[model samples]
Target: MAQPYADTIACIRKSTAEMRDLQRGAMDLDAPGTEARLEQTVRELQARVDEQQAALEQLRSSSHVDIQQVAYASGNPRDKLKQLRAVTAAYTGLTTVAPFLPSKDSMLPALLAARALQQNIRGTKQAIASAEAQITANGALLKQEESNLHDANLIEKALRDRTVRLEAQIEDRSQKAPAQLAKELIAAKRAEKKRHDEETQRLGDALNDFVDNYLSAMLAAEELGGPVVGDMLNVENETLAAGFTKKGKAKATKKLVSGKTRQRRIDQIWGSKIAVEEEEEAPLTEAEAADAEMRELIGILFKTLTGPGGGRAYHQLERDSAASRFLIRAKIAQFHPKDAQKLRLIDFGRELDD
Candidate 1:
């Protein structure tokens, strides 16, 4: 059961695989590879098509046996045998033949030879019938496979065309990436130098300008602290409001970093002495220096308070810990005792009540 063009389609699949691999950026599909791969695929496909065509030609040649051979092999079984006997008798000259008559001794051998020839013909016909039946059973599947191959070929062609276009894109990106980066750098430098004039007749507008640049710089350098937004306020919208803190001073965060990014930013500004024998080459920004000092202070406090032979988890030192009486005074309370007790959960809180 041979499908037409099966091998040709298989070759196309190989080309498709090559195209897919090229897409994965394995080979750039540059000038030499493109032409060579395309030629190789074409050669293979042509070879397969040619080979299948030859096989089909052979099948056709064998199928077209002489009609006369099949014709005599047809008709009723007994009648055909009688006819065959008649023909065989004439062959041995047992019946009237021009100037010839066969003897009984010659007739027997001649008849045996004729019978053998008839049996051979019958076997050949039966073999041809079996072959036809097998062909009929498998022929549909072969044709179906060929049809699917055609669809796959079409998809493969699309993939090839798309690949050609994509190769151009890869080339374009390779050419433009550096130039584009330079362009972005120039734009960034220009933006850095461009400053908005903070001087305005309105004091509110002037202060807002400082807030804008301060936030911008804080974002650029995370060590630079900002106004404590959303603390003791109705919502984030009340960040600009006053009287939140008694001294109106915004509270700073505990210097705990939230993610690797902020930690890296801190490290970049304040180089790590922990990782090197000598100090890092770069000088620290003032904010960075302050943060480093605070970090050192916290480290010392932690080691003294809670490391081995320590008396505290430092739990009692906290403002609301149950062991508040263990400390002489609490320096970390959010408010004066009278007002602070008002914000307690219930029963004036166990810490304050105790």
Candidate 2:
């Protein structure tokens, strides 16, 4: 019987424990090197981007033009070249006058340098783009990781709430077993008590009727000599035993009763097989057997509550005139937690007194 309850409690605890582990797992999604590795990757990518941009800027600003290279403008070469030199001489902070055209020696070097700077700018821009692309890709991954963490948090909370509910339900049911059983026991005991009280009253009434009839019959026999109903059951009148007082003659202070009458009444009742007025029901049937089994169960419940120290405590509850009946019905006339962490019985006897 209790095995089912035990199994349910165990299962609930196991589930809660697993949920607790899952909660930890949710929080630990980014354990050890996960966050650190992501941070390092982002930082390195960004640094490479900064370095490439700086290099590109330096290449763009490097000296790519000289008088020789400016001589190669798109126009009539000699006129355009002299015009460029005059403008360069005015604009440039140089001590000497500018050359109208460049010798072959300087022209080749300047042309090569200009081409090299252009190539460096293109390559550096590509490097910057590549570094930025890596960062962007990793950034999106990090955003996904954050989204996953948010989902994990919600999932963990939902699981925790479920675990809490299961815990409450399991404990409630576990405690309800004993609590419900205790209620049944109380009801059974009350019924037994009421039945016994009724039976006692019935027997008492029957005895009174029997005594009245016997006395009346005895009186009628003494008067008219008609019945033998009281012939064997004569109760002698109580008699005084004489004794001397301190001053003089003997006198009776108390009356003495005879045992003969009592003995006769017992014999008459026993010999006649007189029974209570209630019709006796035959036993040893299915209903009686079931009743006997229920009685056994009730006895076990009794022992579980009041038989030993530290059993279920029956609290004498406080009463409310307005809500006493409601409180009793709600099992709060005297109440305790409906869980095994605390177990007690609530008795309404005090409230009944109130």
- Top model by TM-score, which number? 2
* Whole-model alpha-carbon lDDT for candidate 1: 0.46
Model 2, 1-354: lDDT tens digits are 334644655565566566557656643776554456545555665776798799777866895646465655647788777877877786785547564343332233434554675576566556656655766677789889999999999999999999999999778767777878688779999999999999978975774465344343333222222223334354222211122234433245375434454334323322222222357543122112222322333244345456564345443322221122223344633334452222233433443322
Provide the lDDT at 273 for model 1: 48
Candidate 1 lDDT score at position 331? 36
TM-score between model 2 and native: 0.21
Cα RMSD, model 2? 30.6
For each candidate in turn, the TM-score is: 0.20, 0.21
Residue 136, candidate 2: Cα error in Å is 2.8
For candidate 1, lDDT tens digit of each residue in 1-354? 244444544565566556456544533536575556656655665776798799878866888755456447547898678768867785888445454233332333434555675576566556656655766667887888899999999999999999999998779767787879689779977776653222223654554454343322322222223333222222221122111245545444434334454445445444454232246754443333433433333344435444563322222222232112111123322223543321111112334333
Q: Which ten residues in a row have the lowest lDDT in candidate 1?
A: 235-244
- Where does the lowest 10-residue lDDT sum fall in candidate 2? 235-244
